[model samples]
Target: MTAPLSRYERVARKVQADGRVPALSVALHRADREPWAFTVGESGNAAHPLGPETRFRIGSVTKTFTAVLVMQARDEGLIDLDKPVSAYLDVPAHGDATLRRLLSHTAGYQREPYGDVWDTLITPDAAKLVAELDRAERVLPNARRFHYSNLGLAVLGQLVAKVRGGTWEQVLDEYVLTPLGLRATTVTTPRQAAIGYVVDAYSDAARPEPPIELAGVAPAAQLWSTASDMAKWAAFLASPERIDPDGRVLAAATLDEMRWPLTTTDETLWGAGFGLGLILVPEGRRVVHVGHDGAMPGFLAGVYGRRGGEGNPGALGCAVLGSSGGAGQINELVHELLRLAVELDPAEIRPWRIAPPAPTAYRSVLGRWWSEGSEFVFAWHDGRLEARLADAPADRPPAVFAPLPDRPDVLRTVSGRETGELLRLTRDDSGEVVRMHWATYRFRRFQDGFDGGPASAGPEPVPAG
Candidate 1:
């Protein structure tokens, strides 16, 4: 074990001692540095201890990699995210659901492949898998809610294969693993793979299970990888510059498009739905990718990479590979590891606070102004003026505004990151506080000749007290 392994080993031991998992491996990588790997516990038979080279079936973590390939294809104009999967595949799904919906789990397909195929070790091939799509049940409208569906990703994989003209496994190998130099990563079979084990719920015995062979749903959860390989994969996400692999996988702009939130799942959380095969978790100033991969009876794994920039200085990331079926536990361990790494190497602080705004000589600027094409009614909230989008659905929160430092006439969105200036109020010949200009839009108080007309074409001036 390397020096870095000491901290990770402590985490692995805690997991093993807690009896959550029998054997586990962890890897960590910093930008522009060699990856470190650590392992604990023995294989199913307890005959040998686990090592960095030991491969575990990474369940949903494969989705992140798959998402990348899809985004790469999109960058090359080989596939369109807005188009329906039926546009590429020979089979059709419930509605005109597009690939974007499928990536975000909004497609409403049944949680798993449409059947009892997973109960037995028998998995369907791409053709057989597509045939089952006809019977797939749509639970919710497209883009309704965050519903995780394995079938959705399986469909995405099929679409990638169709667009790229090869198997899902082949596409991943050629596009991602080969470029990243992941030697121990693949969709492996039992003959040349680590045997998975499950702790008998009723007993302390560890029962061996066959390797999960997911030819049809390979894009969903069929990836097999070691901690070392995953560490490199994590680094690529943390700091793209360190491992872009000839810039063929995904352009920075396209990757940013993937990271941008198409819709808000929660107040503080947003996701792109699907971009380059990864599930994005937005953490205020930064973003993180929580990848999933696993199967019953044998293995469960998770890989997460915190979004680089802003708060993440070195762009740190960690990978957890555990053979026991405790997927949730593995996820927790990785989170803890990341917390420690960030504390140890804190990112440079960027102060968002501005100097206090000066007291304004004019009080005319304070008044009700109607926002165009917005349901939000501008009013005061918690001692500060705000605009609550009235048309904003019950789930959508309102935007708040507060005075900026040294600029009393300008108000920015305090609740979210949106910044805008509050234009000074001007009175017409009638001596009424009529017009207020902001962000190129002129606002008239209430109904004072406010024709809802377009403002001047020239750039709007900055707010001055």
Candidate 2:
């Protein structure tokens, strides 16, 4: 056998060839191993071979970075997501749109700023972008639907600058890029970058696209990132719990909040969704990709990391960047590579080993219990106490409980079905857990009926008989 990950290169090669792009660079990052990367085609420079470090404009993927910055600002009590921009900065119009609404693309703001800047190839500076806000249209009611607004994100970037007391680029560099060790992701195109091009449709020719500066809209669509840097970034977005356990760059819990779906991207198909500036594509019910697809005039990129699917949780990210073509091939390449890595070279399974059992006090809470006439099994697994319906599917997660800091008798359901609820354990004189109430419903050794007696204790023992 050739070995795991050997096939990944071949698949990427096929995509690059079929995509007919001038250059395509890709990277795969898993928690367990060193990052894997390669590039195919040319870097538009005869002297420089297109490689992993060759930067490509990531376009709207910049929004995800801005989103993370906004989240960090919120985390540090710099801003409230629910509050309107007017609460933070003075804007001519639409200052009432909330940060959360802007991030989720539900602020009902128009897609772009007031002018046909794209046609003119002229972009505004931060001040002009805001000052011209009066001309921008609020096409729908607040929070009406998913209407993407690059203008809204540009405004948010300005908000970040205003609150952080730095330019958006400077703030992003200090807060995110530097902290995450993303040296190659920058606001300006570097010398060692692939020239973005629009490939000819009917022939084997390509024309280089003119360099466009986003200026004020840079927060929405202005970033040049190498595949290696973006793959790690994508991984961070998907599994910050593993990539950033210490909460250095961004808290893992906050990332979780960002991934929570706000609205479906394709309403009829229910295929993809937008979440706090991230595009969430559910590959299946189990494996969801949390990242964003990016496109400028001549470049396309797809960067994503996996969550809730089979594979090494650590190695859950892939980035594909192309110098030409629509983003379809680049995006398809990432998904395909991710699948190959997981399928051909799945993570090694850890052997079960003997370890300390559940905490001593929770020992009595282990085993089977009946609640609301339904059979449930409570067990101590991996040092925590968990409860689940006896009939729950093998793959279904159980309700895991964490002990309340002040209340020794109470445990909160931290995750699984009855989340945010309490489990109150009742102990007898011996201090053994005799029964419990989960989410305020009683649990017993025997099935308990809603009326408060054992489900099996039939009708007062058939008094008539």
Best by TM-score: 2
Using lDDT as the measure, the top candidate is 2
**Which ranges in model 2 have alpha carbons more than 4 Å from their true place?**
1-3, 459-465
Residue-pair clash count for candidate 1: 21
Estimate TM-scores for all models. Answer: 0.71, 0.95
Question: What's model 2's overall lDDT?
Answer: 0.87
| Candidate 2: Cα lDDT at 407 | 90
Q: What is the C-alpha local distance difference test score of candidate 1?
A: 0.67
lDDT of 2 by residue, 383-419 (tens): 7888889998776788999989989789899888789
Tens digit of per-residue lDDT, candidate 1, span 53-159: 77787888878777888888888888889998777777755647788877777676778776676688677888988987778788888878767788888888888
Query: Clash number for every model?
Result: 21, 4
lDDT of each: 0.67, 0.87
